[model samples]
Target chain A: MGKINIIKKLSFTIVILLSSFLFIHIVNSQAELTSPTYKIVDPTVDSGGGRSESTSYSMLSSQGGALDDARLLSASYRIGSGFPNGIQANVPIFRCAESSTDSGSTNCINFPNANGAQGECGIPGCYDRFKVEINPSGNPIDTLYLVAIYNEDTNTQYFLQSDHTLDTTYDINDYMTICELEGKDTRTGSGCETGGDPNWDLSLQSSNVLNANANTNYTVKARALHGDFTESDWGSEAALTTESPTLVFDIDIGTTSAADTDGPYNISFGNLTAGVVNTPANQIWLDLGTNMQNGMTTYVKDLYTGLYNGTDTIPSQSEDLSVDAGSDGGFGLQIGSVAEDALGPLLEGTTYDLATNNIGTVTTSDTEIFSTDTLSTNVGPITNGRGGIILKALAVITTPGGVYTDTLTFTMIGNP
Target chain B: MNKFLFYTIFIFCTVFTFSNVNAQETGAVPTLFNTEPLEIPSEDNLDLIAPIVANEQINIESSIKLSPAVINLERGSSYLLKIENNTNVTKEFTIVKSAFEITSDRKLKKIDDVLEEKLVNELEESIIIEDELLVIEPYQFKNVSIEYKQPILNYLNGVIVKQRDLLENSDENQSKLDFSGQLASVIIDPTLTREQLDQLKNTITIEPEKSFFGIALNSKFKIKTNISNNSAKLLKISGDITLYDGETRIDSKSLTQNYPSYFYPNDEVSIEFDFNKDERSVFNQIGERSAVKTLKINGEVVQISDEIYVLPYKILVLLILLLSTLMITSFLGYRYYKSPKKSK
Candidate 1:
């Protein structure tokens, strides 16, 4: 009996210890798995159709370019929209019709041809439209005044008031206008002209203006505005700009090559660039360098990863990341995986922090620089500076394939 | 006995260590933010296009204005009748065709009210109702209709079920019950001239929210029209729904376009869809999670999404399996500790 008791006690103690270990492991894994560390940003609005506060969030755009063919083409019509932080407008909401020419102007209203018309309306694209509601009863003014318009395409979205501008032709299609963010306050039945109409297809009756207080509701429509004229409507009636804490971290894409010589690593299609000024209002863009695929749909999460060659080892595999290249020789390096893109799409202008794994600690007194500010986007390094970190590389096409490569760029605000 | 206990304990430790090593070796690395269905734009040749214009019907007060000034019809057998409106402006309206055939003795035999409506917007519109069984049994058919019309386009269409045709007062109209079906259609009649038999068709457009369907996720529901049409010709009906992950895109086997795609003057098409994340783990729903840590469905634009949330049942089942393994190991430990050389 005493032996049995002893065995039971031992077993109980062992079970308790094992259970505790398993419990801690499970909890840690579960927490790490469920918590979302990244936010998705899209251009949408608040209850009233007004400009949103500055969004500290990131953004992504639908693939923009030519349609399958100017005549009778039925490809996926993707247009650009302003998505601030944490909003995924992936659903195809509206369609747009535009002339097949380079102008991309003179298109019909959203979602036009249902049965697929015969080459009638020209090139087709789509835009995302956001509807907002406003009430101006309590505060001071009877009429609320604000600026509203569909801003142009942005690659890098940032937080700086000086970076804003009123460039009219930024969006895929110049659909919405710079009207009052708040609509005119009017009586229930009175007809009022609500501003933002680039196409002016207001067949629906008027009097629906978004007030500062419960007077009317206006729709700040985001249109992919594809030429099919069969555009979709992203029904977002709330403000997208909300003050949120921003994170900052050193995002570096490293390569492996001999020192003092141009390495195999290419910044040719990279999407990051210097800060952009004179862009549209309420719209942000980030251009890492044009390694992204043309007409290929992109996402917020895809914008979060860093591209590194497998030859250069990363600190940990648990790194929050994603990739789309075609090679896999090293830990992170692969051929098709590192999508090579054209240089034209990645020109926003931002300083890049470039580095390579092959260039070990610089011990020599002799420092080197590429001399020219512009690097050879096609072959060798156009320019490389001392300390090996600050390589002010220009946007170039390194690969023959026009693959646009991009990864998520983040900054963990605090000193880590 | 003490030696046996030590040996069993040693065996358990060895087994646990080996299992841990194996798990680490075979475990797949998890990539973040690769959830959400991939947006693989259809690579098919179906030539699918997006819808142009859309609107929701609100505050509609519609009625059917029948002319020949509400005449009485014969009792037995079904009859084809035409509804004519003498109104001037372009007014939107719905028609509710109901009938009851009386026996030869002038008594009602069977009755069925097939309540349906069509939004007719032109100056005049005509509809045909085929071999409708009005009465229950022993009765042929009687043609009857309840039509109401208001000049404005904002008033909603109203329906009323009546047992007998008694030209009563307007107060009796309150007895009519409102309906859920709202009629939506494009007025496609180009002909005018104050005609009495003009035929107009309903333009129906059906579209899915996303090009691809999600595995174990609610499919993109098809948006449809509610208007009914009997004389309109359905034209230009074709749409393609394609699926794609970051890697490959899969198109629907075929696009189905058989007329009267569910709404009235009926031409709208409807569909709900999702795509398979992995073919290997397709049947393994229990404790089975998507290998795609970051999933993107790219059509024109890439939709980045993630699915780290494992189903509760899957977690529970995994826990149970783990617990069973622990129990079995413990049982063996206990048995070996209690019995010595005799078992050996």
Candidate 2:
């Protein structure tokens, strides 16, 4: 009987110790999670190698917190650091916050308190969605979340937080401060804000973090935060390289309204009579397109000083022609009109307006004709900039009868 | 009826004969004006009286383009200036030559002066452009043969290729603008041998002392010199002539003889200089009274000395009077002596 009792006591003590060990393990593992796996999510793999001024990422973890724990996920991002595996030093870390009731429920959140959403709890704002399963599933449910570092497109759910939402109405100060602080909106005047309506991309902002410099490499990694505020180790890095900027320009001889790429362009003003204004049937068309940040400019020049016919000439000589066509002999070019795409308003030269009859002189030196203030938004069949050249000539009775001629050259340059 | 028919036939014959005579007279007169298009003349022909009508429209697709925007033409060599028309239409082009000068800023400035007749004539004579008017087919190029036959010196000029159009009456109230033209710089770099340069330099000569001996009897002394251009090339002579009495400078005057101031080849010009009152006083102040004329010929200073002996009209009159009195007295005395010996 004494031996049996001793055996029972030993067994009881072993069972009790095993039960305590299991309880401690369960309590400690309630809200713990592994680092999230991340990749470029917005720009698909086939789309320019996921390289852009802005970047969107999706983070996923194989496990979630226990159902009873108020668990949430968060992420931090940096540019040009954390290559291959580990994060580099001195790189700025932009922390993402959990979705709270203060922000509309449109954002993703892990577990909600009685207030229907979790607060950031003095942490940084969430980069984007931080979704977590409300009910824990033992089958390794994925805690998937989407976030954008600097997304200009408002339609996408991964847009940044400081920016105005599509449906929200924000004051001018809110828009200006955010855009200015971000250093992304290069447009001038009222175009800096695009918040109140459906056209979210009207005044889209550029990415300050991912500068998207040409021929540069960038890396991104992600980590997850549990409800207990315990953070996981950073996942492996994803790298991308940006493409070079593009600029293209061409000149064709035709009407301004409809111009083609075919060449052999020439301008002819039929026999100039005295006291009459002579204009050519066709004019030069300048076509330009570029993705350059600061836009482009075009210049024109002539081989001769004026319409020279060996012995006689109708001279312009670098002076604007503002007189009645036939009162005196003069030759010059006037800007007819400019057709531009979304990123447009191509500015005419200072002295080359057709409306004011300020015909620009074509001289032996280069003269600016058309220019733009920002990048070109041209697409297929739509030129970002189109400038027209209307050649005008006037000859008095003294203008010697002959075929006057000149050769014109156009030069285009992209702004830095 | 037979008589009336015969009269009518005779009258008709007379009328027809008179009309034929009139037509023949009209045909005999020289035709001064031409209504049709003038044919392009040869390089040697200077008769450009007829107006050339260029009727072909300028084909913009194939503009007239001259290769080697600057033409380097060496003397005594022939060069081909290629003019291209790359359009699908035939084109008529007129080539013209003009004088130009490079400014201080290295820019071309065209000079069109009717007074520069010698320059125009020299240009026409020195460079022979094979054809002044060209008719080029579509997508074809034509070569203009340029022969620098008579090179004088280095000069820069321009050859303009213009689209040609017929002179047609348009709405007088409206203005007309024609096609574009191209100007090719013609740089005439004459590579003359040393002997040739020396020969050219010696083409001008000045007659020395005897060319201006006699002078007007006045306080203003008139001086003259004969300058001759011995070469076939036209020359422009301009310089100051200084007159010196012994070693003392008397006067200086510019040679201002010709209107357009061009010395024709193989022609002699008498250039005269009239001294002012001050110059005459200076001449009188010199004691020796011998004068020296100094002028520049081909950048070299030349001096010609001449003696001055002036016979005043008053002195000549007194001398003639004295001689007449002597003759008269001698004749009277001889007559008196002979008469007395014979009769008294």
Candidate 3:
């Protein structure tokens, strides 16, 4: 009887042990299973009208020195056949230029200035042709709303307002949704990748629709908008603009007459993150440590492997370095990675490596050497038990004169 | 203790359960995409000599404007219109046609080029919504066409008479809303003299398959005959279709005409038709989707050499569907033995 009882107990133990083992095995297998996907990490910014449809007038800056002078400009709208059969014309909203002068006007050509004068416009008669003689003095270096032109044919007239351009004129921010550049994030959880997700928010960004003068230049800036209690931090102020070396420490630097000196710098990353998590990250990660500036900081890191495989010498993706509020106040990693929205799953325990084949620094004439760092962590903490480790680095841009553009590379390794 | 046995049991159970769902539905409803048929209505008693025109040039003595000529009809309707310029100088004609409303808020794109500005200025000068008909100079054909649903009586009247004209033709316009002229006229014949009845019987034979010039391929014609109570009727009539390849009967078919009972003195009864093409026929491909062909019935000329379209794609698709259905039925029969309920 005693022997029989012992045997029964042993069998029970074996069964329980086997079931537990299988359960653990299934979880482990799931966590280890990750699929990587390629994504368009970043979109390109319009440098200025100078590149493609530049005009001699655009080359003229009012800031003196190498800067060209601002001249009077005119614009008009001829409705195409697509116009609706019947719709009352509504006056367009205008954002006044900051000036108006022979050299340059800070006021918008179509917008009214302080003291009842339209700064951007010099000619007082027709709204279509806003002839404002502009001097380059006191130009708004940040992104400015010039004017929103709405041609309502029914009213046979148009209205103009300054501050209500976005609400009254049209929803310009929604334009990104029509363009393929924007996408969603379809990841499973915080770290683990499922399919993909829609782009976080398309309403925050606005695209330029106005036709710049043949010779005129337009400058734009990216304003940081964060959730409540969130602040923006950068890896390096030097990394804000692609003209790194020339504008290296000069937080305010201009690329052309049409472009303002104050803008976010673009850092390019190569195509290293294939569809699987085993591949490299599209952006090179560097540790800026906990100590960093509040708004925008910069970091330089070297990607040791998988860099040369990129199409051009410069990387393809761009970064939008900002601060993550709830997380530690470090510059939120702004690297464009593979379309996480498209990936199947981003399992934990996956070690994503970095590629450094064609990695280099950008300067006006000469090139500079940079360093890289790598870190790894077990996927944990997150509900999905999938977390990733990121590293960062920094380099001081020295070369001056022309603009600078460079690339960073990294790779990821998934569990077997 | 018995891993192999356990594995076998699992496989057997899975197979059994999956197979025993005897009422399993198979085959999916295939996705079908069909273009809305193009519809071109004939106005002013002008018969459609051709439903579709190709590379051929045409000349119209006087300019013809279709208010909404080219109608992108429902899935089964399509329309096409042609205009020929018989004169010398280049003629400019405006073709105003639009598809179903693509968007609710219709807005035109604003362009700034010289030509665009000129067009805008020109448009600003014109206040009327009438679709302009421009004919280019000499010998150039221009088709003023549009594709749209025929509006209701109220809308049609508005289109015919402008707001200003509505005031001028107020009482006379009352006829516009009258449905008598709106509905097509029909003629019926019965209780006619012996000779008249014979003539009617002979004339009411099956209509040979006919097609419009230069339009569809592999065309099959459906003939409809209407008999009115005022016209003479015959008891028996037989007719045969004669396909002519330049005065030759390549194929033929015969059928006896049937008449409905109790044809009132003025009441009209109509017979509809569905025609199938006879495979054993000889013809050559003429223009795009067109074939030059001719048809006759009972030694009477029904159609001269005209362009007939051979819709090979439609026929091929139909055949594929028929073949697929057969194959699926056979496959289902072969799998019947796999069910355990039946096996037991």
Best candidate (score: TM-score): 2
**RMSD of candidates 1 onward, in order:** 38.9, 47.8, 41.7
- Report the C-alpha lDDT of model 3 over A313-382, residue by residue, as the tens digit: 2121212112112221111122222111111122211122223221122212111111111113211000
Candidate 1 lDDT, B1-344, residue by residue in tens:
45655665676576555443323222211111222111222333112122222221110111111111111122222222222111122222233332212222211111211212223331112222342222211111123442222221311222212111112121321211111111111111111222211232222232333322332322222322222223222222222333333333322211222222111223334333344333433223322222121111110111122232222344455678999999999998888777875476
Q: List where candidate 3 sits over 4 angstroms from the true fold.
A: A1-89, A95-206, A209-416, B1-344
Candidate 2, residue A147: how far the Cα is off, in Å: 10
- The positional error of residue B309 in candidate 3, measured at the CA in angstroms, is 17
True contacts kept of each: 0.00, 0.02, 0.00
Task: Write down the DockQ of candidate 1.
Answer: 0.01
What's candidate 1's i-RMS value?
A: 37.8
- lDDT of residue A402 for candidate 1: 24
Flag regions of model 1 displaced more than 4 Å.
Answer: A1-135, A139-416, B1-262, B271-314, B317-321, B334-344
**Candidate 3 docking band:** incorrect
Compose the digit string of candidate 3's lDDT tens values, residues B93-127: 33322111111111111121233344443333322
Query: By lDDT, who's the top model here?
Result: 2
**lDDT, residue A322, model 1:** 24
Measured with C-alpha atoms, the lDDT of residue B315 in candidate 3 is: 54
